[model samples]
Each structure stands twice: as C-alpha cells, then as structure tokens.
Target: MSQLLEPFREAYRNMELLPLLTETALKKFWVEYGTETIEELEQLVEDSPSGDSKIIFAGHRGCGKSTLLAQFGRRMADKYFVVFFSISDSIEMSDVNHINILFAIAVRLMEEAEKQKIKIKPSIKEQFYKWFAKHTRTEIEESQAGVGVGFDLFKIISGKLKADATIRDEIKQEFNRKISDLIARINEIAAVVQGASQKEILVIIDDLDKIDLGVVRQVFEENVKSLFQPNIRVIFTVPISALREVRMAGTLTTETNNQIVIMPVSKLFKQGERYINNSEPISEAIAMLTDVMYKRISRDLIEPEVVKKIIIYSGGVLRELVRITNQCCRICLRLIRRKPDDLDIKINAEVLQEAITNISIDFDTRIGNADYELLQQTYQFFTPNDPKEQRFLDLLHGLYVLEYRNAKLWYDVHPIVTEILQRKGKL
Candidate 1:
C-alpha cells in the first residue's frame, strides 16, 4: 500500500510547491531557452539608431509573450533605454479618450530613466510620476470613491493644462489635440530623457493583448498607430483573437498584418527538441519536455514521465502544460497521506482519468453564464474516445482545455465550467 500510494503522495507534494503556474515560473527554470529571440529583439533595438521603430508580437494567450518580454527587458536593461509597461493595468478606453496611451509610455520612460541613473528635470519628473500614479491607481480609487466619482476632475485637469497661457502657446495648443497631443507629450518626455543620456527609449507594452478585444483594437488603431512619434519605439504583444477580430472587422490591412509578427511557442519547443534528441522521436520530445518542466516546477516530487504526460496533454501549449503539472501535484497531495520521494513515478492512464474527473468537477463550478455555451460546445466536440474529435481536441488543448499525455489527449472541462455543465446535463 505504501508503494502504491507513493506516486500519489509525490504528486501532491509537487502541487503544494506550485500553486500558480505563470510565465514567471517558466523563467525560473529555462533562462537560456529564449536567448535567440532576445538577441533578435536586441538587434532590432540596436539597429534602430534613431530609436523609433514599433514592433508588435502577436500570439495566443499563454504562449509566453510576457516571458519573452521579460527576457528582452533583462537583456536590454544595460544596453539601451528600456521601459516595460502593461497598458491594460494603466489605461482604459474611457481613460484613453481623456489621456492617451502615450502618457503611459511617457510614464514608463520616466521610470526607466530614473532606474538608469539618468537625471530628469525635477518638476517634470514629479508631474509625470504623479500622473502615472493617478492612472495606475485609477481602478482602486474609483472603487473607493463609490457613487460620487465623475470624469469632471480628469477633465478639469486636462482643461487646466490646455488653458495655461504661460505654458508655450504651441505646447498648450498641441496638448488640446486629443491623441496627437499625447504623442507630443511622450515625445517631449523622450526628448528630455534622450538629451540627458543620449540613449533611445524602447517602451515595451507586454500583455496588451490579454485585455478586452475592443480596447486592444482601440489602443493599436486609434492611439498607437495614429499618434506615435518617430523617436519612441513601442513594442507590444497582440493576442491572436484580436488579430482575427481585426481581420473580421476589415480593419487590419495586409500591411498592418505584415507589420505584426506571430511567434508560435510550438516552434520554439520543436527547436529545443532538436537540441536534445536522444534516440526515438517520442523519447526525445518527452525528454526535452521533462527537462523544461522540471526547470519550471523543479524535479522534487514529479517524475519525467509524468511531465511528459502533462506536456502531451498540454498539446504544446506551455501554459497548459505547467498548469496540468501543477494540478497533478495538487491531486497527488490530496490523495496521499505521507511525503513521497520519487519524482519519477508513472502517471498512468488511471491517474490521468482521475485528474480529469476532478478538473471537470472544479471547472463546472467556476464558469459564468456568458462562457457556458462555449464551454459546453468544447466538451461535446472533444471527447477522448472519438478519433474524429482529435483535431477539435488538439485545438482545445491548444486553447488549454484538454491535456496531452503519451501523445494521447485527455479531455477535461475547467472545474468551474464542469460544474455548470453537470447541472445542465451537458457533461
């Protein structure tokens, strides 16, 4: 019984160690994995002597955009001026109509300049920081204000800045011109920083794609593309769904799509596989996955084969793979009574089934009304026993629904969604 319970115990211990599997977790393990992409981005930064090229990286969610951006940030910190900001955190559509995203960019530039020991004008610096603090903490403040909050205060400030006659007529005049004014302000800040340090500023907007689709379009089309200056280079991540939405809306032209680069995480994994091939194709993929997974979550409780199962179940989606590994760890812990040592125990078909069952129960309980229909359709189309459903299951796995193991796929609804479906008799 002790031997039988060992794998379960170990899995449980692994889960205890990893509660949330995010890009940060992956970075802890595979520091060297994204070196090439970082180098390419660095080269892009280096080649732009004038410092004004915008780069958009679009990919599916959980495809490691944030991780790649973090890697780029680390590499460029010493070489060129770099400020990483997420627009989703700092700006909203309503906010955008008031103060453009360029304000966020300006704030990021100021912070990075301060970090690099570049001296900025004290008053200008304080004003930028204050504005940034206001914007960054907007959500919290709105919640605190409760019922009486209005856009009037924000408009008053904008009016004051615009009506200041002593502030150069051109500057004040430019300030009132909507998005263009924001760009001018960002350029002014960039110019000030550049004058002090003689370095070009690269503002990286990571995870912009993770926000609402409409907002994503508004930022890129209305603010970013329309108002950007030549001296401030903006790099941001675009979500694949946003791209599809833009295409469907007939807003994304061929030229715009060409400007946006799609970096598939699967391609990176394939490259890693080549670098670490042993004998068999399946063995090589599994081995590479184990090394990668162990690096992300450590190799204390889970075994290589179990990691392989997680990866196969993940359908090459890095986020899903980490999530499954993390979940399995939790499941094993809940089932076992004692600490287990072996991290190489097999996560057989039976264990996989059990995990999915638990996951389904958890998923159904959490999903909301708006997402119910989609979740139901996904489960009905991706059953494990049907060969005809493989493609749909693979897509679902890519989207992070099913887990891939031993080159075979396992179907499980999200715990919150699963509960809903069960109640509806759709499971």
Candidate 2:
C-alpha cells in the first residue's frame, strides 16, 4: 500500500487495553496527568517524621491510578524501600479483606527483601519463613530450614496462597479472630526491614478498590485502624465510588490524619459545559488523555474529529480512551483487510461510531431499572449530596457514571450511558 497508510497497519497492530505495568510500556505511554495529587501524597509522607504514614486513596477504574501508582513508586524508590503490588495478583478479589491483604503484604515484603537482597538477619528470615509455613499448613520435616531453602519452600506456599482456596479460607479463619496477632506479625516484619535497610518500609497496595463495595465498607469503615497499626508506611487504594460513600469518607478522614488522595479523571470540558467549544482553550487534562491515544498510534491514522469525539465519550477515563481508540483501530484494520486495494482507508467518523455503538451495546446489557433510575436522577447533577445510594455507587463502579473533580466535585452519566438514558426517555 501507500507509505502514508502503511504506518497505520503497524500502529493499529500495537494497541493494548491493560494498565501500563512494565517499565518499557510506561516509558512509551505514561503522561503527566496527576502531578498535583502525587505531590500532595509525597508531601504527606515526607512531613510525617515519626511512626507509620498510611494514606487511603481512590480513583475511577480506568483513570490511570495503577499507572500513576507505578510512577509514584518509582518516584519514591530512593527514599523508601518500596514494595508495590496489586491485591488481585496474590488473592482472589471476591475473597479479599483486610486480613488477606495484610497476609499478602507480609508475604510480599519478604519476597521483595529476598529479591532485592536487602539484608535481614538469617535468624529473622528463618523465623518469618517458619511462621509462613505454619500459617499455610506446610510442615517442616527438617528441624532447621536454611534461609535459602526456606525461600524456595515459601515460593511454593505463596503459589498456594494465590491459587488454593482452602489455604486462603484457613488463613482468613485463623486470623479473623486474632487480627492483633496478624498485625503484630506485619509490624514485626516492617520494623525488621526498616531497621536493616535504614529506610522506612512503604507498601503501596493497589487494586483493593476493585473488590465489592460491601467489603470495602467493612475494611475501611470498620477495620481501618487495624490496617494502619503496622509500623510501615502504606498506601491503600479504593474505588472512587467507595470513597464517595458518606460513612467511608468520614471514617477515613477522621481516623487518619491525611485526607484521601484522589486521582481524578482528566476533565475534557469545563464542569458546566454541555458541548466542546472549538475556540476554547484546550485544558491540560484533555491534552493528557489525547496524548495517551496518540502515543499508541500515529495521529494521522485517525481523524481529529474521531479523536475529539472519543475523548468526550471516554469521560476522561484513561482506559475508556484507550479501549475505544484501540477498537477503532481494530475495526479500521479489519475493513482494510476486507478491501486490500483501499489504500485510502483510515479510522474515520464511521469507524469511530461503530466502536462507540459496540461499547454502548455492552453497557446496555449491564444497565437495569435501578441503574437507570439512578442514572435519571444524577444524569444532570452528579453531586456528593447522595453519594451513599447503592444504585448510584453501582453505576460508578460499573462506570455507567463518570466522576470528575474541579473547584467543586461533580459527576455525570458516562457519555455513552447518557445517550442510552436519553434514548430511553430517562433523561
């Protein structure tokens, strides 16, 4: 085909929907969208000279929280012995709670120290290893398991912790009643690591937010104090919907000295604007979202009109922006394959609409009477006044609604959801 259009084939082939977890992917696609929030978080830890510093934060699912967190970990690497991990990688999301979370943290801390060769006394390592074996029901035939031998065994136990339901339930059952015992173990490990490394331990627990809201309420609202009792500095993430709940918000701020650090969706339009104004100044947030798209593909492959509409429809959620554009690229490539002679074909308005319609259809299946009723209520004013409503919370969790922050925080139905609601005469 022609040289200009040939690049589209390569760009479209390289799109991805998952979070930027690897070093190389992040370097290529990461943009500076949440500088203020990250700075505020950094300040929170730096200012806390004594004891543990725990910060609970929230963001919408696709708002680049995971990617931003990777950046944060890299930023804080020199000052703290950073151990960052997502909860889902270790435990099942449906079974996640504070107990398992602490369990995972302890496991990860040792794993990290071992991987990084951070010096801990051999006696301490052996003690921690035996404790893990006892809790995981792995018996030691040998009286004394060497540190090297123990790590190899612990890897097996760690695999069971992630995959075997029986072990998870047993650990939860065992620790549920004696939470102090578990926290004591966590604090002990943290203290040992900090003492050995000469830096405070910072554990960034990502994707705890992806669990059910009821469990979130139980974890943060009721048991938050227990989660923070460990000596290490920790960052816990919740879904943006969980943070908006009245009781959850109050408990977090009141119990913890620091306010929740929110990674907000980049706003493509002014809070009050109904439509994108061509002559208006393009906000930095909008540029961040668009740049995320252009970074993955050649800008010439997709029409500017298509990109603009996708941004608005994305509702400033980074995942949506990537997903929609990625799908558009996929559709364009498939069409090009169907008509191999068409060198003029690119991602056009029709391709954009096709991708949009396919996604809207998926949302259509998920929306119900309760969701639609809540959507009708908050379609215009997605205020915090009634943020505790379960239906509204579900909408936020499902991304049927998108939340944004400004001088005042507000919400709106997802652009695709809004169109669906309008067509249903609910808005």
Candidate 3:
C-alpha cells in the first residue's frame, strides 16, 4: 500500500511547475506543434551572411515559450554553440536594465566557455571586476590562489549589483560610460565561442518575457539599439503585451529585415467564424496534453474524461493545462480518501468542477462590469481593438485571457474565467 502511494506522492512532489530546464524532462514530455517557428529561426541562422542574428521572440507568460526556446537551443547544439540562460534567474524583474542583461550574458558565456574547456582571458576578468568594484565602491576581497576565482567573482558581482539599487545605478552609469568597451568584451567572448565550437554562438536569453511590461518597454523600446548592439547570434524573449504598445519599425516590424518574430500561440482551434477544436486533421494535441500528465504520473491514476475536461478549461495553453491538471491531482487525492476506491483511483467531473470553481473565485475578486464585457467579447469574437481595452492585456498576463491563432490571431478568456462571468450573466 505504501509502495503504491509513493510514486503518486513523489510525482506531485517533483511536479514541474516551472519551465523544463533539463534535457531528460524535455524529451519525456516533449510535444510537437507542427509549427515551423524553430525551423524559421534555423533557416534565418543558416542564411545569414555573417552567421550572426539578433531576434526578439514574444509570447504570453507560461505559454511554453521558454520551453520552446530551450528545445531550439538543444536541437541546434551541433551547428550552433547554444548558451541559454534566464535573465530573471539572476536579476530582479521589477528593476532590470539592458546592462544587467548584457552582464548576465557575458557571465553565462564565460561559464559555457569553461564547460567546453575554452578559457576567457584573465585580463578581461580583471577589467570587469575593476569596473564593477569602482562603481559599487567596494574593495575586492582577497582570494586564495586558483580557488575558483572566476566563479566566486561572478557570484559576488551579480549578487551585489542586483541587491543594492545604489550600486546598480552606479554600475549602470559606469556601463553607459564604457558601453563600447563592454560591447568589445562581449564580442571578444563571442569570438572565442564561435572559434572553439567551429560554429556561430546562439544565446537564447529566456525569462525576459516574465518581467513587468514597463521594464519590457524600457529594455526593448527606449533602448532598442543598445540592447541589440551585441555582435552575436542572440534571441531575447519579450512579453506579448509589448507588441501592441511599442513602435515596431526598427526592432519589431513587417519589414523582412526586422529582427522581431511574434511566435504565435501553437495553433489549437480550427479557423472559422466560430471557435472549434482542430479535430478534422485529427492531431494529437489532446494526447500531448494527456502525455504531459502521464509523464509525471500513471495514466490509470487519472480518468481520461477528467483530463479532457481540464484540457478544455486550459484553452490550449500549456502552462494553464499543467496548472489545472495539478489542481485536479489534489482534488483526486481528497476524493479518494472519502470513497476509498482503490480499484478506481481517478479524478471525476464533480471534483474537477470544484477545482475550477476554487480557481474562478480568485478571478471574481476584482473584475468590473466594463472589464467583464471586454473580456467576454475578446473571448468570443476577435481580440478587442480598443487601445483602451488594455485591461485585456492584464487578463492575458494573468492567464484569464488566452491568446490563440487560427488564420490570424485572436483572444479568448480562460474557460474558468468565462464560466464565472456567464454564471453572473455577464457573458
């Protein structure tokens, strides 16, 4: 009895609530969208004259965009020396700068180079620490000889700069003063990576999309030139909300040469005047959604109809699906104790609806009727066109409004959110 419950307990204990970072998890739960997004990126890299490209990829938070980028880096590892890192992992999202981003990239590059037995010049390290210490007004602590000095130095610099706002500002000013030098050092590291791997360096900086919209504007809009100045093949994740607000001519535009690529949501619904599941082609989207749960837990442990209901509620967003499924697992455990049905340990519709009801309660806390109508129309029809409908962007970020693609793009409120609205006669 204990042995049977152990796997069930452990699976939830090790549930991947965040993006998949390891290759093993990625392989076991991977799903193909039949979307050529990665292929387009590869083609761009292959056809580039200088073997260098800078791109901005945007998607809603928790939309598996990070997972997609990570898979891309893994797939192209043979041809491109891929170094993927998350910016928010090292810096505070509320207060981020392009310089902080560049610094993180440089540190990650150095780390990757060391992994590949390539050495970064000690002079570059010394120069970086010198500038860092000068701006922060701190004395460099003495270190034991050859005691992982590079690694220790990196930790100290990143830790201090992120924590101390005064130090961060000073460093930003210093970085601005020596922006050209910083660029040179970054390019120098890029050169080594390309030379050692016999391929171009591809840096996928993930999690920038998870930052605040204001910071997104600061990094990609106001400072677009500086952010894109790094002389390397790079892809930076931007927030989906930024696309509707920022001027796109230089960075994100329809121009063939523009660097931005709006990775549309992996298509789930068929194109029509009305929304319907893409069942005619008989794709395995539903199966992929189920496989994600099975990869973590046993299939028989979960009822197929329960999983299907959760998938529909997820509105085809991968993170939303995982979240709802996680809730359902909890519901199943509670229901199992009441009934003691060891022979049929599965979630059912009643518990699934209860789980969704709990989630919907949170959705009801702050919405006004005007916002409710905006959400309703956005969910039912095409995406709302009124710039005043910025509340919809908030809904998008909050996972209440899901972005989807047919021939063009559209938005729909999360099933649970809509359920709450309809229950109130607003939809």
Candidate 4:
C-alpha cells in the first residue's frame, strides 16, 4: 500500500512541478482572459435597455463563446436579470423544429430568474411552466408514439383554433401568438423591474452558431426576430460560417438588418483598445491569452514557451490557443511515463513538429479525395507574395491555424498542424 501510494504521490508532485504544454480547463481560466469581451458585453446590455439593438458575436469554433458567456453572466449578475442558455448540447436544435428551442429558452430563463431571486408574478410563471411542460410532452409523445398522433394532434389543434383558410396558417398563428404573449410577459416583468431599479433583462444565447445551420437561420430569421423587444437584450454566439449562410439565404429581415453587430474575437484582442475606448498591444493580448491557458490547465502541463507556440499557432484566436495547448498537453502526458525532470517537461520543437505533422495528416485524410488536388492547387496558386496569398493567409487565420500580421508575411502554422502537414507532404 505504501509503495502504491508513493507512485501516486510522485505523479501528483510531478504534475505540480511540470510545465504545462496546453490549456486543459479553459472555462476556469476564461475568467482572467475574457475581461475585454465581458466588459463590452456588460456595456451592451446596459446601454441596450434604453434602445433597440442586437449583438451577434461571430467567431470560429472554440473561440471562447462559452467563456465569454460565463464571464458576461458574472458581470451582469449584479445589475441585470441575466438568463443564460447554451444550445450546443441539444440534439433537438439540430433535427427537430425550433419550438423546442423557444421552450428551452423560456425554461432556462425561468430557472435562472428563480435562482437570482427575481420575483416573477406567480400567474405568469405558472402559465409558462405549464406551457413548457405541455410543449415538452408533445415532443416526447410525438417521438414515442410516432408522427401519426403528433400530426393528428397538431391538425386537431389547428382545426379547432382556425378562423383562417388553412390549418397550417392557423397553427402558425397560434404558436406565434403564444410566443408573443410569453415575450410580452417577460417584457412586463423587465419593465416593472427597470422602473423600480433602472435595471434590465439580458437573455444570453450562447452557441447559437453551434446548432444546425438551418435551425440557426430559422431561429434568427424567423423565431428570434419576433421575440426581440426594447427591454430585453440578447447576446448570441454565431459561427462566421453561419453568418455567411444567413447572408446567402437572403433572409436578413428589417428587424435583424441593422441590428446585427458582428462582434469579432479580433476586436477584443486589438492592441491599445480599452473596453470603453482604449487598445491593448499585441504583446499584452498574447500575454492575457497565455495566462488564460495556464489557468485552464491548472498550471499542470503548460510552460511559457508552449504558450508562445500555441499563441502563434492560434492565429490570434483565443479559443484556438486554448485548444492547441490542451491537445499538446494530452500528447505530452501520453508520451512520457516516469515523468522526467524539468528537461522532460519542456515541449521542444521536436514534440511540436510531431504534433503538427499528425494534425496535417488528419486534415488531409479528412479531405481525402481532394487532398492531393487541393495540395497541388495550394502550392501552385499560393504565392507567398501575391495578394491572393494574403487571402489564403486570411483563410488560415479564419481556421485558427495561422495569424495574419501583415500582407503576405504570415507566421508558421500551429506546430502541431504544421508537423502534420509536413508529414503529409502538403507543407
């Protein structure tokens, strides 16, 4: 038993002593690195209560949307009645109709309101609970009993409610009315609270872009548009790809048109820019991001050099930095058995080279049929000095693989990804 304990103790101590290669626990570290965006979001919520505006936060995957939401939640908790919801984990958002998404938003908000000790009128709360329960029941029953009962019930409800020409129209109108009424009730509560304390209500919808692209469009273009109100401020995360999809769909409505604020991750990291009106240097931005990664991993595996490598690889994307750091740390742990001294902990160029090679190979395999073709095209058309080369650099920047400092002068791909590409002969 003592022998076994000795090994465990040694491992723990080694972990403490070792330099971290990557960020493993990003959510916790986010508190330190997310100040700029959190402050901006707080300001937006504060100012939006007096006007009608919407903020659409757009970034690549792993760009710290969840972290931003968590930090913003904390910042707004004191003054605003903040309700946070993330749809990334829900399968319904990917496949089912968006009614479930609305129901989810209401349920999450009500729960949050309760947690915050906000006194919601009992009648409104009860009605909302019942509506959510019924909606959930309908969804479950439909899934279990097949579409026959669901379609029949839908038709029955439509027929009974219809004073219009089509059952479909009737059902749509009824759903819309219920949703509107719910939003109105929420507004009423917000208005009363604002009158009392001059505070506002913020509904933070994180991971909006993580859902199915189609559902995202439906929610923003159709459902969410109707739900927007002056007293209610919404901050939703959107993928850059999804934004392009929205633009392509031509579904940008009047309500969503000018209200859309593309809050790029780059904006928060800009040099010398204060939250209110200042900018931070590139060095400061990198340092903050490194601190964030260090905190996330409990300072267990990442070292300063590794953080620098991750920052370079991340192409100025916070999320990418965190992810690459996390991955590298995991790789390092798997490779070393008896945990060597400080020398062993250092993630040298070789380790990074290996990681990048594997990643590039994985990417190539993922793009199977087009791997060779794309590589050839990339090599032929991608001249480092050409303007088109800058576009390619931008593409890599968008992918969080490389950062663009100037025209065609770009840094190397993340050590991990670069290694992979080299192994695959694509570099």
Best by lDDT: 2
Query: Cα lDDT for residue 424, model 4?
Result: 66
lDDT of 2 by residue, 143-246 (tens): 44454565556567677788889999999898889999999998898888888888888899999888999999888888888887788788899888877677
Local lDDT at 66 for model 4? 68
Tens-place lDDT per residue, model 1, 1-427, is: 4453755454444433322224554455553444555666666667765567766676656656676786677667676577776655554423332244455465556555665657666556556545543433322232322222223333333333333333323332445566565666677878888888876667887766655555665656654456345467777676655544434224444423344555554422321232244622355445555666665454545554555556655545556566566666555554553435543344455566576566556554544554455556655654434323433323343353433222443344433344446778765
The estimated TM-scores of all candidates read: 0.62, 0.92, 0.87, 0.64
RMSD of 2: 2.7
lDDT values for all models: 0.53, 0.80, 0.70, 0.49
Per-residue alpha-carbon lDDT of model 4 for 1-427, expressed as tens digits? Answer: 1222333233333323221222343332334544555666666656553544556775555656666566667667787766666654332333423444443444555455544445545455445444543543333332322223323443332222222233323334556657666556555545654454455667777766665555666766666656454346666665555544435235443554444434344322322122224343367667766665555453434456666666756656665554455455555655553444433453456666566555555554544433333333443333233323334333343452332233332223333444455566765
**Clashes per prediction?**
28, 0, 0, 27
Worst 10 residues of 1 by lDDT: 142-151
Candidates arranged by TM-score, highest first = 2, 3, 4, 1
User: Residue 220 CA error for candidate 1 (Å)?
Assistant: 2.5
Residue-level error in angstroms, candidate 2, position 91: 0.3
Per-residue C-alpha lDDT of model 3 across residues 1-427, encoded as one tens digit per residue = 3233555565555455788778986877676753577887777767777655677787777778887888888888888788898886667777788887887777777656655645445555555556545655656753411335655655665676567777767657878888877777788778866776677788899988888776776777777677767888888787777676636434555322566666665444554322454444224667776766667767666677777777777777777777776776676666556655464655678767777887788888867888887877776665776633468667777777767765666676777887888898876
Which candidate number maximizes TM-score? 2
Runs with alpha carbons beyond 4 Å of true place in candidate 4: 1-28, 31-36, 49-52, 89-91, 96-98, 120-125, 138-198, 222-224, 227-231, 245-254, 263-282, 296-304, 336-346, 368-427
